[model samples]
Target: MTDSQSNLIDRYQQYRTRRFLANESQTSSWLPGWRTQKRRRILVGALLAIFVAMLAVGVTCHFGVEWAPLLWLPVCLVFMPVWVALRVASGRQDDAPEAVLDEFEIDQRNGARSIGFAVMQSLGLIAAFYLIFGAVITNGDNGDMVYAGGIFTLMAVLIGGCTPAMILAWTRPDPDVDDLS
Candidate 1:
């Protein structure tokens, strides 16, 4: 990369690091009572269920169910922000740069990321197979299938991106009462 490109990338990383750190520091006030493992697990489950619903809506819309998009819009707008909050509440352990994390944290983050990557690869392969076989099955009249494929790909991306944070949130212990105070 050119100097300017490298500098831009570095700046963006710094910004992201700062943002995550800020979130960590302010999480209690911003997302009160969400520090519990049980609540976080619920949030993760809800997010996954929403993603599945989104995929269903996308398929339904492809089949001429026109009102599905109306349901999708509000859900997307609301839940996506919740996903961000979940990442923040989870301490951004999966995303914080290595320098910001301790050895144990780094190992945990890496393991979660590894699992997320594997999930992504598997889902991506499924999406690819769907597109290819779908086109063949339709004798190349695959316009609707393309839309479905796109939605499936997007669902894959969302699930894969969130997996690490979800894993961390679900597995992490509740904050110590002393620590909360």
Candidate 2:
């Protein structure tokens, strides 16, 4: 091979070596600015609050809480997961590197962002469902188990919000020489 070609290959290899070392030496740090911690705290807090609220509603219903007030319970439950997912996904920076993509960096980024937006938008549809169900339950003067179900549903939505981050982090691409090629 020509000297110039050898030098080019050497430079490329050097770059790849540096990147690999950097990746290897770097600890898995959380996102900067306490955002990661804050997000975690909020997620936990939301879950705890939902649990407490559900318990209260359960006890009240078991005893004698008014059915009208209880109607909102389902709404809360149903909306929780959607809200959590929206909050988690939306709070992320648009340019944030969700996962490394040597071959299809743009495609992966675009897909992640698109998925993030879709999750966020679903919140509106969920909220609408909550409102509609809430209205119907209240209007009919019903106190059925549906309200409890709704509140639980919301909690599930909130829980679902945490998945994207976890999945993104878990599936993050590893450094490869070809990636730097």
Candidate 3:
């Protein structure tokens, strides 16, 4: 290559390296501020709280069709994975490289996030369908169980999965080059 071309290549490479390193250094030590934490916490709580309230209603009223509170239970299932993710992925941030999750943990979290996204997308579609055609029902005995059980389950799983996945995506540090592409 010509000297100017070679110089240009070198500069680009250096720039890339410097930029990558800068990202690593900055993100590695990044700790969420109180305000950010408060916001995320509120978001998560609000998202999950609706499901919990529904659950309380279902239990309190014995999942009655008249109350139709039982329908809320299935919708609340997404809370499970989100809660797990929060527990597993919490406390991950520091200057030390070892402070971050290893490849396996990172991969697992990414996989979970992907699943969460898919579940959430599916929930959106389901909601749209329900809005257009009314809640899913069939010859399944008075339509209450189908509405409360099937639709509720979908809602729960979506909320539960999406909440934690969002929290992780927002709060977790950028992965090291070796751990994630």
Best by TM-score, which number? 1
- Give the better candidate number (1 or 2) by lDDT: 1
lDDT of 2 by residue, 1-181 (tens): 9999999988876776666446433522323232344454555455456556655664455334567454555757654673444334333322333232354654655665566556645754664565567658678454444454454455445434544543343344333434222
lDDT of 3 by residue, 1-181 (tens): 9999999988876776566556665544334332244444654575567566655543443334475554454544655544433332333221113224577666656665666667677766765554444333434344544444445455556464554445554565544445422
Residue 95 accuracy (lDDT) in model 1: 85
Per-candidate TM-scores read 0.82, 0.33, 0.35
148 Cα displacement, candidate 2 (Å): 8.6
lDDT, residue 25, candidate 3: 58
RMSD of 2: 14.0
Q: Write the per-residue lDDT of candidate 1 for residues 55-80, one digit (tens) a residue.
A: 88778866756566576777688677
RMSD vs true structure, all candidates: 3.1, 14.0, 11.9
